[model samples]
Each structure stands twice: as structure tokens, then as C-alpha cells.
Target: MIESKLISKALFSDKSVKSVNNLKDYAGIEYIASMNQTHSDLVTFVKSSAVYDSDGIYTEEPKLGLVVKTADCMPILLSDKKRIGAIHSGWRGLKSNILEKAIKKFDVNELSISIGPHAQSCCYEVKEDVKKYFNDYTELRDGMFFLNMSKVLKDLSEKEGFQVEVSSICTICNSSYNSYRENKTTARQFGVIWK
Candidate 1:
């Protein structure tokens, strides 16, 4: 698990999906509320631990870790002093403006955002069909097109009056974390946050 400097309670999992679910052993979290994560724009306000059909989940309750699982998709953790949230942002989520929807739950000025490992521009190649959703963030290199999701995420968050600290680690480039694009792996890592 990787702890954040901005918020010590927030953690980005380097372990497998199964191991990360057992947060009690490592994070001392009593309950874990993980999202179903359909890559949609649904943002759910959570009070306790339960699976919700949402790509973004937030909580004001203490010890209830908001977990987001991802392979190559971005795992974003949002926290103020009292509330915490987690978001699963892939191409679909970004297109749907999932980050904008998630941050609206909290005071933007008080929000501290952290983006975990994901497929970066260096390896996040997309097809012509996917380019329509992100024309501003995509670039043509050689014969392939690459998407800069970090720029889209940061720009969106900053425009909302908050700053975002994005992780430099790219899941596709790092063997330590699972990458669906890199190896078609079914495994996913987790990002957790608690009040």
C-alpha cells in the first residue's frame, strides 16, 4: 500500500485486489465501501460499508474506507479534513466528466486530490473511435493516437478551484501493479480513503 503525503489516511494499493480488500489487517479500517465501478458518471454518497453501483464514492464517516479498484484506469482519492472520496476514472468515466461529478460533493477549496497509478500517455494508446470523447487530450504519434488522461483530470480539478497531485507511476509501465492494457490482466489494485 502507498500512503499519501497530503493525507496519511488515504492509501493506494500495490497489492492484488483480494489482498487490498482485507484492509483491516493493514489499514486498520473497520469497514470498506468499494464501488461497483461501471465506468459511469454515477457518484454515490456513502455512509457505511457496502458495494454501490457507482464509479465514485464518498463518505464523511470515520473508519469507513472508500475503496476504488483499477487495473490501468485511474484511482483518484479525494479528501478534505472531514470527508473522503474515491473515484474510478477510465476513458468512459473521463468522457462522462466523472471527476467533476465527484468533486461537487465536497468544497472545492478544501479538497485535496490524489490520482493513483494508471495508463499514462506513453502507453495509453487509443483507437480512432475513442478519440471523439477526448479530442483535446489526444495526440497522434507515429501511426497511433495517445490520450493524456492526467492532463484532462488535472485541468478539470484545477478549474474547479482545487489542486491535484497525480502519481507519476504508470500502471502499464510498472510491473508492480496490474495493467489490463499491458497484459490483459483481470487483476486490479485498490485506492482507499477514510476520514
Candidate 2:
């Protein structure tokens, strides 16, 4: 488990742990709320511990850890200390503006965003179908296209008047984390945050 010093009360779990339930003892936060991410723009508010059917989950409830499970997709955590959120941002989620919808739940001036291990542009090569949606953040090399999720998300969050700290670890190239694009792994890492 790795903690971000810039974003308090959060941890980005690597392949060492497969589920948020296993992270309870390690993170010291027993109750965690998670969601069945569908890569949509759906953002849900949490006041208790229960699995939701959305890509984003946020809460003002104390000690309720909000967790987002991901393999290669971006695991993002949002917090202002009193309130916190976890977002599962994939290409579909990004195209739907899930991050922006979650940001609206809090005052942007006090929010801090953390992006965990994901498929970076270096290894996130995409075909024209996917690349077209992210033209401004895509790069073409040797006639192939790559999508820079960090740059895309960072720019989007900054434009909303908040700072974003992204982990440089690329899941596709790093063995510490699981990557769906790497090996079609069913395993996932958890990005958890709480007040």
C-alpha cells in the first residue's frame, strides 16, 4: 500500500492486495464504501458502507472510506478533508466527464485530487477509434496513437481550479500493479480515501 503525502487519509494499493477488504487492517479504516464501476459518468453520494452501481462515489460521512477498484484504468481520489471521493476513470468515463461531475460535489478551491497507477501514454497505445476522442491529449508515434490520461485529467482538473497529483507508475509497464491491457488480468487495485 502506498500513501500520498500530498493527499491525506488515502492509499493506492498495488498488486500486493487484491481487494479493499484485505486493506482494512493495513489502512486502519474498517468500513469502506465501493462501487461497481461501469465506466459511466455516474457519481453517487455515500453516507454509509454499501456497494453502489456507479463509477464515482463521494461522502461527507466520517470514517467511511470511499474506494475505487481499477486494473489499468485511472483510480482517482478526491478530498477536502471533511469530504472524500473515489473515481474509476477509464476512456469511457473520461469521455462522459465523470471527474467533472464528481468535482461538482465539493468546493473546488479546497479540493485535492490524486490519480493512482494507470495505463500511461507510453504503453497505452490506442487505435483511431479511441484516439479520436482524446485528440488533444493523444500522441502519434510510428503511425500509432497513444493516450495520455494523466495529462488529460490533470488539465481538466486544473481547468476546474484545483490541483491534481498523479502517480507516474504505469500499470501496463509496472509489475507492482495489475493491468487489464497488459494481460487481461481480472485482479484490481483499490484507491481508498476517507475523512
Candidate 3:
């Protein structure tokens, strides 16, 4: 009962109210809740309208929509036409395999995935410790290490037996996209999917 869509910048105004309204506009889905987003491997399932009261945990009511906002972090979308999930995956989240964990919670063979715009390694410079977490097979250019998050997620989706499509847009490289690294004070964008 879940479907994925990459919202255009015009829909989200970098404001929570506007973003939430935009989501409502697209699918009549409301903001149930979101997490503090520590970039951990924690994956929560939202199933009720009440879950929106809290942001850090999962719900069980199988509601109509779910959302996650991001600046540089990866917004991982999951759905199978009956249930749906959205996760914020930064380097720390990626290192923890949050996407794998989330997908495992559902019967996702027929699920579809969409990796919303996020900070690419091209614009996401990290310290050595953070850099070391990714496999050495990751691409590098211009003295900065880069990971094709969409590719990684797409591969994972295929492995999980779900159909997948990825957007090549890079948040950091594209001026149209919102990026925490590019503008420290700018607002973030929402990556939303629901059934």
C-alpha cells in the first residue's frame, strides 16, 4: 500500500508547515511523526495516525502516509502497496545498514523504492573515520571520496526483490536542491512515500 515519489523543490518551502501541507496535497497523507534522526540503524514502522505524536519510534496502524526530511542525509523510501516507511540515512545511517533493516520488516518482493535527493560524496566531505566506513570500491574524484547512494540502495532493493528506480540528482551539486553542507542556514526538503 505504499508508493514513492521525489517531490519537486516547489512543493517544499524549507518550512515544516509548508512541507507538511505539500505532502497532504499530494496524497492527503498527514505527518504522523518523525525522528531526531541520529543517523543510526534504527528503522521504525508507522501504522497509525497517533504515531505522529512521537518522532523517534514506529507505529503499527498502517496509516496512509509517512515522511522524512533531509538536507544532506539520504531519505530511504520503502513500500509494498500495503505498508510504507521512510528513513533518514546519513553516512552513519548508511554504515549501519538501516535500509536493509527496514526492508526486512516487511514482505517487500513487490515493493518499490525511491532514493530522494541527498548529499552526494562529491559535496559530502568527511573525516577519515567516516570515510573508512564505506567499501573501498566507492568512487572518488577531485580529492573527495564519493559514494553513489542511489546505486547502493538500488542494488539493495534488487537483492530484496523489489522493483527500483533512482534519481541521479545530487543535492549538494544541484543548486535547485537543498543541502546543509551548501548552506548552513537553509531549510531542508522532505522525502515522502506512502500507500
RMSD of 3: 4.4
Tell me the whole-model lDDT of each prediction, alpha carbons only. Answer: 0.86, 0.88, 0.60
In TM-score terms, candidate 1 sits at 0.94
Tell me how candidate 3 scores on lDDT. 0.60
TM-score of each predicted structure versus truth: 0.94, 0.96, 0.78
Q: Looking at model 3, report the run of 10 residues with the lowest lDDT sum.
A: 6-15
Model 1 regions more than 4 Å off:
none
Candidates sorted by lDDT, descending order? Answer: 2, 1, 3
Scored by lDDT, model 2 comes in at 0.88
The candidate that achieves the highest TM-score relative to the unseen native structure: 2
Q: Write the per-residue lDDT of candidate 2 for residues 61-133, one digit (tens) a residue.
A: 8878888899999999988846788999988888888888999898888989999999999999999999889
Model 2 / residue 49 / CA error / Å: 0.9
- Mark the regions of model 2 whose C-alpha exceeds 4 Å error after superposition: none
Candidate 1 residue-wise lDDT, 94-128, digit = tens: 88888888888988888899998899999899998
Best by lDDT: 2
